[model samples]
Target: MAAFSPELTVIYATIRTLDDQHPQATAVLVGGGRVLAVGSREEMAALAPRAHVLDHRDLILTPGLAEAHIHLVAYGFSLAELNLHGARSVSEVQARVAQRTMNTPPGTWLRGGGFLLSELGLDEYPAAAVLDEVSPHHPVLLFSRDLHLGWANSLALRLAGIRPDTPDPVGGRIVRPLGTLLESASELVTRVMPVPSEADFLAAAKAGVEDLAGRGYVSAHTMAFEEPEAPRALQTLAARGDLPLRIWACLPHERLEQARELGLACSPGSLFQWGGVKFFADGALGSRTAWLHGPGFAGGSGTGMPLDSPDLIRERGAEALRLGLTPVTHAIGDRANTEVLEVYEALRPLADEKGIRLRIEHAQHLRPEDIPRFRGLTASVQPIHLQADGPMIRELLPHRVDTSYAFRSLKAAGAVLAFGSDAPVAPPEYRANFAAALTRRDDEGQPIAPAEALTEEEILWAHTRGPALAAGWEDEGIIRPGARAAFTLWDRIGGNARALVL
Candidate 1:
């Protein structure tokens, strides 16, 4: 019998295969799901006469996209819950929940997320009674748009064992007259919920990863928020050789010791790796907790919550570097970014010595002068965030309009711009990222700061090469012979297409 060789698949088209040497390979030879070679259609066909061929003549093929930052498990859960992301007022939120309750069984949890206090047009926290009126029997748990704060109904408060006397946790706050929990305080309620079994965890992780792959994502950086088992669940998938895409996970700062004891360092493996140490510097803009300098927002009374001291961040960040882990901090506001940049500057020499780069997540808003300091750092930002935040940004940070989501300027200042959708906070919508980054327009169709908008090519680079560089994976982002075989097909940017990867 003739030697049985691996079957080949030749993808043909006006190809945009992102291949170097031949950046526009009209045909690709794929074997065992990896691109075996790229050449002219005649050349590829001659080499693999028995190959099965796929003709995507109308599509553009590019490197598989990467979401530089996201919270995967949380996004999976949010997909099953009520979405109040764009509710324009508190009444809108209440009405939606009330309608949802009418269909839901009486005692079931009325779980929901994605309410923005700014979008709700509320000057202060909503009274817990407001949720009580509509959800008297059900325990209502609503996460703020940023996921930093949670608003609960009376039933949920009781369920969480929280009371007026329930003192705030060290790194969180329990609002007075009882309804809201910030930061660590949100965990009080979350901790009471039943832990999902291994099956549930696998199901969620699977759904989330599949959804991303469908959206042209070949890789993601999962920001840790859940228990240690969550990352373990992801590891199980990779270990079993069942994982379809690359996953880089972070360990919360508190778990640093645990990670150390396991002798885990960044870049531990290819499929699943412990890549970064995550820290929260301040809250979110939607919840009005984004730390800022001087007057917080134009008309808002508060300047936003001050969070983990810079000194602490610097100290812990250095330790993470020593352990060969990338230190990534979430900083939403100018003040938050300012402080984090300061911490990074203090530890720059060490980071350089250790060959680790510091990343600042959601560097959404910036002070004019501080923008340049992001130079040589990874600004892991979410362009999809602008769609939901455009209007509110106009109201809150009107004075800093030109500087908010300053993509062009950040790039100009020499920052590596990695774009992502902080799913659960905002769904992982690459089309939306393309639209928002290129247009800088809000949902209302008004330009937030037109000058800040990026070109289509620029947006693509940020979502592709910028993210790969940030993750320290040079070979994966570009389409080269030795690069990992991952590619996304596109009919057009901001349009539908399929993803193909090995």
Candidate 2:
């Protein structure tokens, strides 16, 4: 037996179906939670005489939006933690931790993230003693918003057994004299902490989903880092018919074999599907670990860190393609992007052979010459980060500023631009992304790249079809008659819209 919609429900008035054939169609028929038919209002009504009708007299109807990248569990965890994204100085950060500690138990771990080194106004990493002053009894661990670095007080460092003599861990650094941990180094302290229980995972997952929905997202690509129980929690919600948004999950590379054993393949559909094999190619911009090219940041001492070797990426990428998984890797700086692109170039034939699309997350900063090479690849980018990164770009890579976030250049090169928030890294606010994409203005009101600014229609396309293509979601992200009925209704672009669950 199949489901039929409540008879006679026709949505009318100024419908924009995002269909090439009927670009400005004015009506859509809904049944069984899918777009049954789309035509002129008179044509649709005659087909179902007694159908209920919705008049969207003043709204723009478009396909439901999708977030191309985010860490769902981390975003949920951040909701309850102290945020330090804009701490102007070490004192400001201490003030926040002090306030948080006051309300926390005497010996409880003070857990929070979202600090930026540049915002801290420190030339060097702050000393742990600064944090120990207010959080003497409690163990305090504050992670950089990018999650690539961690700032910890003396107590927290001691608890994690990190000392001046502690050598740098493989592929990570413990900032000396006792204060910060970089990349894999942060894992030491994190691993020692108590793991959140199943109940915690469920709560965080629920909150994260609700937050996304509130921000007008109809779906998301959750890059896995959460515990095994996390995806199960989402499955539970979906199975009980409680999920309001669709999820496309990417398991960490470590679990690739397990996923393959379970018969998981890229673009495998079940409403919610396993979309890709996620991997980290390098660290983040904030932590100065973003792998950079030869003339690395004007005054910076190092040229950033190389996370996963190119050989490793190539090997894993090939394996993922063989198993029908999209290879999505995080690459930030020019060097990182360049190296990963090289890996992709090598894997392109195989990817094409397997009918897979190669996805590069955070194609943030790129060497102009390399932009064209991204043609036909998925540039899963975050426009919202530009707001915060604009100033950094000026100070760090001034010469390349024009080419950074080169949306226009990349698009012209034939690359698919899939915009996203990289949530938890920044808040998952689609409105912010829209504003940033259209305006190209930094927090200081400076234009990072005026020429790269996209129009409302282009941004909408990137948010919808770009991601759809990246994920290989054929039936979604369009408003044609044969498309799924999922859509959002807004009076205008960049505003909160009511998601009509068809």
Candidate 2 has an lDDT of: 0.83
RMSD of each: 2.7, 2.2
What's the lDDT for residue 161 in model 1?
A: 93
- Residue 149, model 2: Cα distance from true site in angstroms: 0.9
Deviation of model 2 at 146, angstroms: 1.0
Kindly list the per-residue Cα lDDT of model 1 for residues 1-502, writing each as its tens digit. Answer: 1321447677786655444467677887777646667768888877777788888878877777898888887676677789998798988999999999999987788778888787787877776798998889888888987888888899888988999999999778898979988887888988876677888778778788888887878999999977776787788888888777888889898888877788878864468988899988898887778888878887855778777778888888888898898999999988999999989999999989987778999999898899989888999999988887888788888877889899999999999999998887888888899999998988888898889889887887898878888888876776655566677788885577567875
Q: What is the C-alpha lDDT of each candidate?
A: 0.83, 0.83
lDDT of 1: 0.83
**lDDT score, residue 429, model 1?**
86
lDDT of 2 by residue, 1-502 (tens): 2333356468885666656887777788887667888878877777776778898967878888888888887788789988887788888988999999888888788888777777777667777888988889998888888888888888888888998999999989998778889998988888887789888888888888888777677888888866677788787777777778888888888788787788777555465777788878888878888899978876955788998789988988888898888889999999999999999999999999987789999988988899999988999999999988888889888877998888988899999999888878888888888889899998789999899999888888888778888888777788876677778788787787767657
